[model samples]
Target chain A: MTVNVSVTVNGMRHEISGVEPRLLLSDFLRDTLGLTGTHVGCEHGVCGACTVLMDGHSVRSCLTLAVQANGSEITTVEGLGTPETLNVLQTQFREHHGLQCGFCTPGMLMTGEDLLRKYPLATDEEIREGLSGNLCRCTGYQNIVAAIRSAAALRRENA
Target chain B: MKPARFEYVAPASVDAAVETLLAANGEGKLLAGGQSLLPLLNFRMARPAVLVDLNGIKELSFIELRGESVVIGALTRHREIEHSPLIASRLPVMSAAMRHVAHLAIRNRGTIGGSLSHADPAAELPMMAMFYAARLTVQGPAGRRTIAAKDFFVDALTNCLEPEEIVVEIEFPIPQHDGWVFEEVARRFGDFALASIAVSIRRGQSGIEDARVAAMGVADTPLRLEDVERRLCEIEIDVRMPDRFCEWVRSSVSPNSDLHASGEYRKHLLGELARRALKTALAAKGDRR
Candidate 1:
């Protein structure tokens, strides 16, 4: 069966109809809406590669049914900032080598972005704890923690 | 991993949800924070003919303290409970335990009611609820009814909840104990526990006034080992007794062996955890309690 769900994706609202109950939010965002920046890995909810902001909270898009997101606001990696105007977290990720393969980068950025916003001056341990859910096979989490710390410091100085 | 095709209903009210569920009989599944349900759907492990999405029912998503018990709305996400100051203070075991569930991403979308209804034997929330004697409130075509934690969990991946019934909230009684411990052993962080234990002890001038030990991943459901607790009664609240109790606990539970670990290994670890957790709970008292 089909359902009508009006989801505000990346600040742009869309009144979607006939969406399958089985359609994952990650699939809808990437395949349907063409928001391909949000990657999908470990659809069983282990990997945070599919992480996105659902009403400002980091949720695994793959594990979330698109219908479950009815009337909710979502922010994808594409919403963070473009190459022309990079967000502080994005800058920090690249500058501090927070990513290597870049597959887990979007999830890392979104998780780190949400974390730093909540804790602009978070300690090294807090940053690590905050991003523990997002896994990066290449970076070993050392550089990711460093990048998040650096982003936090940058946000703090600007504040 | 597409789910089986089914009818979808996004109900705005609890009564409407109940009606929708009744119309489908036992063929419907209530969708809360879809962390667990969606995965089951993706894997095709659970394919309901109709999914009653409860996200539209905003009233069933809250964490409030009612007298001694913290009434957690069924739709309340695990992330909310993890950060809630009320749950942190009143039922710190739940807050502390929730962190060990899958991770931040799963917790952000996983609901307390969902986890409880899923009834994964290794889940932290179910064991914590069993230890605290949390009351599960359900709304169905028959009206509302409350079930004690013991009665709620019928078996692994099963509960007493009826077809048309929806779990609305879980009420955890304020633990009277001045001491508590939540411990688990997993192969990696965020993985399901091979075996876990949550213990609460209340000490008085008369010695040990109250003690409760609920173990997970050892049986079909989270079990409150009353026999072990009974053996611990009248014994002095000290280092030696807990060790002895652990030895007794080793013989009590018959845990199943799976890919994570062997049943014998789980029994061995259960003894060690019981001893270690009891000691830690005793030491962690006075300041937090």
Candidate 2:
């Protein structure tokens, strides 16, 4: 059966029609909407490559059904600041060398964005806990944590 | 990991959800936060004909202390429960267990009712409910009813919940004895626990007054050691007695071997962790005043 779900992605409302019951949010964003920035790795919810923001909260899009997300606001990696005006987190990630293969970058960015908004003054340990779900095997989490800490510091200075 | 095609129903009320389930002829699955069910769908472990998304029903997402018992709505997410001050005061063990759930992102999307209904032998909240004798409230077309934790969990990945019914809320009694201890062995930080135990005991002047010991990942479902609790009540709280209690715990549990840990190792750790937890709980009991 086909279902129509109105999803607001990256500050734009796209009334997607004829969405399949089995269409995962990750597939919906990448295939239907052509938002290829959200990669799909380890579709089993482990690798965190399919992570995105549903109502401003980070969730595994691979596990979420497209129909269930009707009328909900979604924020993918594309929603964050662009290359010309990079968000503090994106800049810090680049500076700290947080990505090698960049397979897990989008998930890490969305999770970091949510964590910084929720916990602007998060400690190093809290930051580690915040990013626990987003796995970065390439960096061994050292540079990822550094990036989040740096972004948090910049956010604090701006605030 | 696309899920199989299924009909989706966004029910607006609990009663409406029950109606939807009844209409599906028990071939529907209630989607609360979808932390566990979503994964099951992706893996094709569960393929219900209908998916009743309960996110629209806001009534089932509350956490409030109603008198002596702390009542938590079925849709309450793990993160909210972990951060709730009411649960912190009434049921600290649940808060403690919530900390060890999947992870921050998973916890943010996982609901308590969903976890209990999933009934994984390794999950912490089921063992916590068993240890505390929490009551589960179920709602259906007929009416609302409550079931004890011991009676709620029937088997691995199963509950006593009727197919047409939904768990509306869970009530955990605030223990007069605040002394509590939780210990678990997990391969990774956020992975399923290999063996876990939740122990709580109250001490009188002469001996152990009231005690509860519950273990998970050692059986098909979480096992509440009622016989062991009775045996423990007979002994006086001391450093050496815990080792003896450990022996009783070992004899009482019938653990099964799995890839996570062998049955022998689980039994051994059960004794060790139970002993340490009992000692720690007893010590914490003395310091409560």
Candidates, DockQ: 0.61, 0.55
lDDT of 1 by residue, B1-289 (tens): 3788888888999999999998887898898878778778888889899889888898999999798888999988887888889887888777778778887677778888889999999999899879888899899988999999999999998999888888998898897888888888887667788888887778878667888888898999998988877776667766587789788878899998888889999999988988888878777772231
Clashes in model 1: which pairs? none
Q: lDDT of candidate 2?
A: 0.85
Q: Weakest 10 consecutive residues, lDDT, candidate 2 chain A?
A: A114-123
DockQ score for model 2: 0.55
Angstrom error of the Cα, residue A157, model 1: value is: 5.4
Residues A1-159, model 2: lDDT tens digits: 788989899999989888887788899999999999998987777878788998878888887877767889999999998879988889999999999999999999988887887765468888876776777778898899999999898877887
Kindly report which residue stretches of model 2 are placed more than 4 angstroms away from their true locations once superposed. Answer: A117-129, A152-159, B285-289
Q: List candidate 1 segments past 4 Å from native.
A: A117-129, A153-159, B286-289
